[model samples]
Target: MKKYFLKLYQYNYWANKRVLSALTSQNVSDEKILSIMGHVVAAQYLWLHRIQGLPPAEVKLWGTYNLPQLVSMAEEIGTRWLQFVESTDNFDRELTYHNYTNDPYINNVENIMIHLVNHSSYHRAQIALLLRQNGFEPINTDFITYDRVITGQWKD
Candidate 1:
């Protein structure tokens, strides 16, 4: 399970970089695009905090961030997630956390991690749609694409 989570997180981070790079390289200054990406990073941070038993009272779900800031924060949070996944011994540990609306719920680490990835992917698809509507082609972030790229170039 740990190895599976590590790979999924790796793909998450890789796809994020691809999305960010595509936006920046195309000089996309769309406020909505940046907002969605910012939310992605912020949500990752919030989830990490919750899983680690840290307070996330100040996290902004729709914070405004420029592409540069998003790039930096994305990398930072991605690295932190990788480290956390690497260090955690049990994925089944349950955590109780409150939602932005102050609603409480309990979920295990594995489930939360899965939610994090799916949540980011959901937002990424939204960004991609926005990109297409704005006259730009969306980057292919499919898992198969990532797998092919990595296996094609990576030697173990």
Candidate 2:
């Protein structure tokens, strides 16, 4: 399970970079894309902090960040997640944290990790759709695509 989570994190990181690169190359100023990416980064950070038993209020849930800032945050969070997956021994361990509305809840570390990845993928798809609507060809960020690249089956 640890190895599986590690691979998911790695794929998350790779897909984020691909999207960021595509956005940067376009040099387009799209508020929707930026906002969605910012939310993705912010949510990831919030989950990481919550998993570490920190207050979720310390991170912004809907903060505005430009492309460069979002890219940096994504990279940093990716590293943090990698370290966390590698170091944690118990995925089933429950963590208690407050939601944005200050509502307290308990959740397992594994579920939170899965939600984080799925959340990012959901937002990334939105970004891709927005990019396509804006007449820009977005990068393919499918997990299978990343797997092929890593396994030397796809050249990008």
Candidate 3:
């Protein structure tokens, strides 16, 4: 399960980088992509905040930044998330905690990690679909592909 989480995190990091690359060389206004990416970042922030039992921070409003700004935001968020994973001890994975909304949640570290990955994956898929509808060819974003890229192994 820990390996799965790590693989997913690595995959997400590369997939997001690809998306940011695709955002370049397109004639579409920055507003379109930036807005979508902002939502992804905001969602992660909200969930992380909730898990930490903290109030949600004010999210950056959409249509407020250029493509570069959005890319930078994604990079920063990604770096922080990876750092959090790195700092977490193995035993902590099973610890439980409540969300900011006071909802009962399995504070198990593994579940929370999975939630983060799934949440980001959901939003990235949405962004890809939006890009396709807008005539931009969405990049191939597959876990297997990411595995190969990061680990140099094509294990099935």
Best by TM-score: 2
Q: Which segments of model 2 are wrong by more than 4 Å?
A: none
Global lDDT of model 2? 0.87
Residue lDDT tens for model 1, 4-111: 999999999999999999998999989999999999999999999888888783658898899999899899999999999999878898888897778999988899
Per-residue lDDT tens digits of candidate 3, residues 69-116?
667877876776666566554724444444445566566656766776
Look at candidate 2 and tell me the lDDT of residue 130.
95
* lDDT tens per residue, model 2, 32-88: 889998888888888888888765534467777888887898899889989998998
**Candidate 1 lDDT for residue 115:** 93
Every model's TM-score? 0.94, 0.95, 0.73
Of the two candidates 1 and 3, the one with more favorable TM-score, higher being better, is 1
After TM-score superposition, the amount by which residue 149's alpha carbon in candidate 1 deviates from its true location, in angstroms, is 1.2
Residue pairs with backbone atoms closer than 3 Å in model 3 (clashes)? 93-109, 95-107, 96-107, 97-107
Q: How large is the C-alpha RMSD of every model relative to the true structure?
A: 2.2, 1.2, 4.1
Residue 87 displacement in candidate 2 (angstroms): 1.2
Shift in Å, residue 40, candidate 3: 1.1
Error of 2 at 143 (Å): 0.6
